[model samples]
Target chain A: MARKAGSDGSKTAEAIRAAGLRLIFEHGYEGMSLRDLAQIVGIQPGSLYNHITTKQALLFDFLVEHMTRLTEALDAALAGIESPLARLDTFIEFHLRYHLTRRMEVFVNNSELRSLEPQNRAVVTGLRRDYERRLEQILAEGTRSGALNVPDVTIATFAIIAQLTGVVGWYDPKGRLGEDEIIAIHRQLVVGGLLPIP
Target chain B: MARKAGSDGSKTAEAIRAAGLRLIFEHGYEGMSLRDLAQIVGIQPGSLYNHITTKQALLFDFLVEHMTRLTEALDAALAGIESPLARLDTFIEFHLRYHLTRRMEVFVNNSELRSLEPQNRAVVTGLRRDYERRLEQILAEGTRSGALNVPDVTIATFAIIAQLTGVVGWYDPKGRLGEDEIIAIHRQLVVGGLLPIP
Candidate 1:
């Protein structure tokens, strides 16, 4: 249902989504309860329906929204980047910065895939495959132009994505390494991995 | 307490561990219950205490046991490997093969780390650090000897581990690629990433 303009419904809906993401990130989707979620959002249990109809819908929305934002952001980052190697560099930088700042989304997206029901799971998986395909196309382009020497484009795609996204698992903003330093390290690891060996 | 030799108690203990792993893998640590675990094992809830004292203890044991066994296995894998490059190759092969066959362990190890109690979490985290140090040392030695050229060994260590351990998330036993092919892909990505560029 659509919320009327100037109504509190839109704000409440956004609050519900933020609360749901935090709860699912801290506790798995299976472990979070509607009662706790409503409490966190400062609403009555029954009133939760005004924002989210069901817990399953909340989870599906969370995953779909995350994947949608990721793909759109990537497309924005890759815009006007013509060289395949340069496109790959943009991907590595974009993934690390995006994931590091959005740890909740990254954790929930990766860990809660199993909690999604089969139908919901299929949709989320399809979105993820589309994201992977973007990187695979870049790798294929690089291989064709002799700019990269990946033994297999598909494996390289998965490995590079994994390596880049891993920053979320251990990155600390106050830690020794600065953002640029971490990004540069991963850039070298990824770009160097794809370079033609002499 | 120790079970009597040759008694069903030993078998029951093994069964409890196996059942616990499955339940925790399907449901988060917080989402699983001793009552359900007992029901799955075909035993009374009270009898679960005979195998595991409490759920917290069970979670701790699960994580600690997983980390402990992983370190021991790594030690065995790297024994008597003298060359830094060869040792790095052994690390890649060992990590990929080990994680691929133990998808449940990898999932629980990565996902349920948040569920571990503070003291238990520290112990498990320390064990993991020790394991990472094995690779860090190998990388440092290679850099000192001018055989490897990692920009930052610490970041490289985390990135490489995450890249290698990620195989468990998507690998399929009946898929097009066999185990050897998967290993070669990762080995090339890692070793090629580290080799000095001429």
Candidate 2:
């Protein structure tokens, strides 16, 4: 649904997206209802059609927007970082910091893949692969330059991404450890893991 | 509900649990319905009550059973292993292998915690803490012995477990890499991550 920028329609669309993310995060995608979503967004139940075509579309939008922003932000973070090792350090910090504050989006993204329709799933999966490739390229370049000892680039990519994203599961903004401290610990683990053993 | 050992009633109860796991896995806890569960189990809709008390109870049971089996298996795997490094290695291998086959249970366990009642959530959380503590203790021991250069036992433990458990997310039993190869790659990532830098 297209709407004029800054108009009430666009504002309502944004509100719907935000509420959809929260509902999908708390209840799995299959469990979120349009009625409840409309209620939460303070719209009549039938009026949700003005913003989203379907619940499936809402989920797809969330995932696509998330992956797109993630990759774009990562690119911005790594620009002009020439060396593979330095770029890798930057990637780790960027990923950890980005994911730390977006726990709900991350949770919904990971857990809702099964709920996506096949074609939509493919699009989201492709976006995810694109994201993964960013890390894999970093690891592969590091391996080639003799700056890192990643035995298998693909496995290392998945392993490192998983390890970094896992921070969201336990990270608390108010927790004892600050964000920098958490990132520092993970940097040591990930970068330290890939460094060739002397 | 109590039944005689090896009775048909017990067999039916087992079937109900298995079917419940698959249903809750495919559909989230809230999405799963008793009617569908009964149909899947080949019982009349009303007959589901004979075996399971409520959908919430069934979910609670699945989680409790999964956690109980997981901790027991971990204890068995770690038995007679003395060295902290060896125990950590054993843990990586054990966790990888155990989670590899029980993908559904792990998915439901990780994703459906919100659906669990507060008291049930507390029990499951405690079980999870106990399991995490097992690894934390191993890291602490290795750290104290100067064998492992873990800066923080708790953070290291969470990172390693997340890295290992992630195998289940992408593991294909018939995929190119065999189980041993997967375990070896992860062992390198995890153990290499913790060793004191030269």
Superposition error at B107 for model 2 (Å): 0.7
Report the lDDT tens digits of candidate 2 across residue range B1-198: 896677988888999999999988888888888899899889998999988888999999889988989899999999999999999999999999999888898889889999999999999999999999999999999999989999678998898888888888899999989889999999888888789877
Fraction of true contacts reproduced, model 1?
Answer: 0.60
- The collision pairs in model 1 are none
Q: What is candidate 2's lDDT per residue for A16-125, written digit by digit as tens?
A: 99999999998888888999999999999999997899999999999999999999999999999999999999999999999999989989898889999999999999
TM-score for chain B of all predictions: 0.96, 0.96
Error of 2 at B171 (Å): 0.4
**Residue pairs with backbone overlap in model 2:** none
Q: Name model 1 segments beyond 4 Å from true.
A: A1-4, B1-6
Candidate 2, number of clashes = 0
Once model 2 is optimally superposed onto the true structure by TM-score, how far is the C-alpha of residue B87 displaced, in angstroms? 0.6
TM-score, chain A only, candidate 1, equals: 0.95
Error of 2 at A52 (Å): 0.7
Candidate 1 residue-wise lDDT, B1-198, digit = tens: 996887788788888999999999998888888899999888999999988988888878988888888889999999999889999999999999889989998888988889888888888899899999999999999999999999999999999999998888789999989989999988888888888878
